[model samples]
Target chain A: MTTPPLPQWTALARDAVFTDPTEMLLKADRFDQTIRRRNWREYAAGVSGVLLSIGMAAFFAWVGDYAIVGAVMVTGMGFLVVMHNLRRHASPVERLPEEPCIEHLRRQYRYQAEALHSVASWYIGPLVPGFLAMQAAIFWNAAQDRGWEEALTDKGWPFALIVAFLIGVIALNRWAARDLRRKLAALETLD
Target chain B: MTQAAEALYRQAGAQFAPALARLARSVERDPEKARDLEQEMHCALWISLARFDGRCALKTWVYRVAHNVAADHVSRAVRGPQRVALDVIETLPSAGNVEAETAEALVLAQVGELIRRLPPVDMQVIVLWLEGESAADIADITGLSAGAVATRVHRIKALIAGHFQSEPAYGVTA
Candidate 1:
């Protein structure tokens, strides 16, 4: 059979009512409110983390565990650093929606890739000082109680596991960033 | 919203509202969900118009923002039906033929089915094409080169033709 004439696809919505400008603006305001609410939630979580870390550091210091206090203080600093990073990269500068789709998509991919690429510094590195201090405190305590040999024997596996987990996280982020960059490259060639 | 933005939105709503509704329907099958999607598109368009500097044609900007919102919606619906690439689209079964008095309605439904199965990029191209946009205009909206748009349009046409061929009794075309 010969191909029949195509229908006017726009006719499918011939009776579609144009939403009023006031209603549209209301919807836009609601959308903005939703985004603001989400941002507030993220801030709440980050603030809670910082406050908890600070409280922990203070308690540790009061108990005369200066080593743990140092570790806790470093961890508190880590929370602040992480919060800053999250806020910075939480969203890219809002671009005009009039921009071409490819450009918008590229921006999104680049934003993600950049965030993942710096995961080691902002995400992983911040915790390293605190992690090491805590480990050192444990090692010193065990060594004083028993001996360095027993401390190494007893704590070796746990230390190795922590190191392995951190490395794994960094490696995974690197792989994801690479993948996003590859997608970015592909999208670049699309237009 | 500023008066200027509201004025622009009114213009866009007056001009592209039907097309936008059809676009939402193309992406979302359920009527309730489609209406929600349409409202979302309207909301996005209204906000996006705040930055409208007349750098591009209003039609182009409206379509770009609406399609982007639809793409985001699809991305978030990870558990929804999976879309396919253009090359492999023909392998998928066509929509079951629905009996309607007018061949146009049937063809519209069939085309809608085809659109919903396509990846976002291809879906944008075909939707623009079916809405009577020129290849250059589609290129402007999608940021695809003119040649890329042409190539995709040709492939999409072939796929649509092939899809309809499988159901000869429909006496329909897209």
Candidate 2:
């Protein structure tokens, strides 16, 4: 069947209409719903991580008798959560503008790109001090149990591996940031 | 749901619900997903009302919000490299004032199928054009220049002409 002439589409377009969004509009705390829907997966991951850390922290406190270190980890997590919540509530993401769809898209890409680029600071950096203190506590405990030289010999490679892994993570985040920058630049060029 | 924001949202929603639904249909082939996208688009529109600020026409703002939400949904739901975000589009009413899905339903279905095959950018421009938006309006909504909208409209006309070598029932004579 051949389609109607172009001018006739406007009327036909109404056939597939969505009902008055009054219900949604009236009771729709849409931002809350949207934020919940969009970020639930991320929140799940975070909750799991927190639970695991709690287990680890308890082990450190009771088994390892590393109360100071355990306290640091738990407290740091609390601080991180509070900071995250505060920031999220303070300045929500603004909506898409009316200029053009492409511009709105690029703005979104740019936001994500910026977020990924700053992950080390907002996401990871907060944990660093606590983690380093924990590491030091572990070494101190190990050294007290074994002679310093023996502890150094025994733990040296593992410590070295961990430091290397952390470095690798930082490098990977940086690379991802650069990649996003390139993508954002390309999106800008399309305008 | 600040009262002011809700007031603006209700007004926009009433005025442009059709456009929002069509925008969702264009982006998503799956009906369920289209429904979800439509709701999400409405929600986005509501939350976004606070930022409208009278900078652009209300129609421009509505389409921009709807299309942007649709684009974002396509990326998130599809999880593929962003191939152009396009979808099926309807055509204009003739001087005869054809209802959107009258006897023309079959023809429109065919046109929708054809339009769906175009890249999202072209699909969007053609869809807007078909909806009787001015070239300037299409340009504003799609972020294309007037020249670019003209070019895409030209391509769409050619595409339709190819599909209907014989006379089309609704007067889309090439």
Candidate 3:
């Protein structure tokens, strides 16, 4: 192997990269500040998500007939946001700088893959029970206006629309799961 | 633990600062970004030392961390543009007009640029070998088998030999 001597590259690096010793000494101090800032940003986004979910729940609850569906959605969105924020911002590896790079990469991939696959649990699953309650409530609330048979028959098309909507939500989650699975499979090759 | 980590940081940082700088410089073309990467490398070393169990040689550990950081920096930089394989690069021609006086510097810069474009595994081995690491050391740092490092080193040598114009006084030049 006739490898060219790389003195020029080394020289260029030495000239360009070497800094005052003080800079090296103070790196940890600066890193602390960066970490604090990042943490603040993460918490801020999470708080906003919680607040938005509350607002959504409140607005939908005010709609009377759609109150149950709205509450379920609020719960679902809140759970998803909280779990996602935790995974995205508060990764253990970010603080554990000593962890090998390959380990870090694998950790990140693992988190993302789990997050993607969990759309049903933290996201869609939370909505399922609440959604069923909401549908039952919709029929009951409609029944107060007329006879039970009248309410059921009259509300048929609207109930069909709501069922279609829920199916669509699950389908979208499945699509996301499939996409994440592909990414996870690709990432596994590196491990 | 803090004092031990700090002492180790200073010791390792002093020893490998030059190599880490070279790694960062190889990854980033912009001086400002390279400086930032260099600082990041230092910070990483300090944090990484807290967990340094000495399972591997200190030199191997440092490059593992340094190259990982540099590769991440390079990956971020390359995300905006399409990257080609090294084979594609091999088919391309080298610049022919660099004067002997400036040929060395230009070649070094071009080599750094070429390195920045490579995939992470290839990039890591090539960077360590170019920086004068032995095959065993490269394997230690990269977690690749010794045979793998030898094969990669061979390929890198051939790649460089084919692409870079050589002079009799390569590293001896001013």
Candidate 4:
């Protein structure tokens, strides 16, 4: 026997209520705009933080104040730690269907893991260097204000500390990105 | 976007809106939820319009976006307690126009319920098939190869046929 043609009339009856598409189209546009605005807001926040860091460095340098510079360094480090923790702890936004086929579910999870890894790398790769550069500029400027001998002797310990901190930050960022990627890859291979 | 892009959006909306609504209703199983999904899909499509590089037919792209939106909305609804209150419980006429329409609606509703029970990929294939999408179009929308779509279509049809045959009282009237 031949297979039946699809019940086109039945489908049409089901959709009888939604005859107008204009409203749907408009709502879609509005949602798109909202998402775009959200992304812009996140970008603005990041730019603002970077600007504040630069501003603090400049203000402290003009006043030859190591105390204020030290405070700013601590504040910047604290902000980075908070932002990193918040990002790391964020829940996955897209939830999978409850009873998806095993194969399909696996594929979906793999895709998500890959995406998360991409995002983590995208964030960490530039963040480490940018963070270190800002810290260096601030510390170096404050040290230079003193006479050459005094600056060299006084700044040696602080400069060494900053270098160590930079190395640690870069290593930590790279490790976090790589570890997340590896864990996600492992999830893809699980039963 | 240019005027041509804007016109395309308008034209695509006019041409595909009814069909998209039908597809959403079939999968969503609730009217209010269907409307919500439709709105979301429409919004996504418009936003994604700029990225449409003419690599695929406009209809195929619209269907893919609509299917994704409906799937996402339904998943959320199932997980949440906000049980979609049956939209106003539409009244059906008792005779002639209403009778035929009601019979048709009942059949479609049963079909929709059955389709919902299938695996997501299979359900998508069946819906696309019912929408008169070609194998090639289904492949494009699904990111599956043409051969894979054809195989899945055969398996899905047999599954639906078996389901209707086994559950005689489930609206399979002579």
Best by lDDT: 1
- Winner by TM-score: 1
User: What pairs collide in candidate 4?
Assistant: A28-B43
Arranged by TM-score, best first = 1, 3, 2, 4
Regarding TM-score, does 1 or 4 come out ahead?
A: 1
**Ten contiguous residues minimizing lDDT sum, candidate 4 chain B:** B84-93
Tens-digit lDDT track of model 4 for A51-78 = 7976886798788866566656555655
User: Poorest 10 consecutive residues of model 2 chain B by lDDT?
Assistant: B86-95
Q: Is the docking of candidate 4 incorrect, acceptable, medium or high quality?
A: incorrect
Q: DockQ-based ranking, best first?
A: 1, 2, 3, 4
Model 3 regions lying over 4 Å from their true place: A1-4, A15-30, A52-191, B1-4, B75-101, B164-174
> Which candidate's DockQ is highest?
1
Between 2 and 4, whose lDDT is larger?
2
lDDT of 2 by residue, A1-191 (tens): 12324544545446444434566655466556877875776666667767777777777667657655465675558555745743563353475445477676666667666665666666566666666676667677789899788888887888788778877787787787687577567545544
Model 3 CA lDDT for position A61: 68
Model 2: residues with Cα > 4 Å off, grouped in runs: A1-13, A29-92, A96-99, A147-176, B1-16, B46-56, B81-126, B130-132, B150-174
Clash count, candidate 2: 12
Between which residue pairs do clashes occur in model 3?
none
- Lowest lDDT 10-mer window, candidate 3 chain A? A12-21
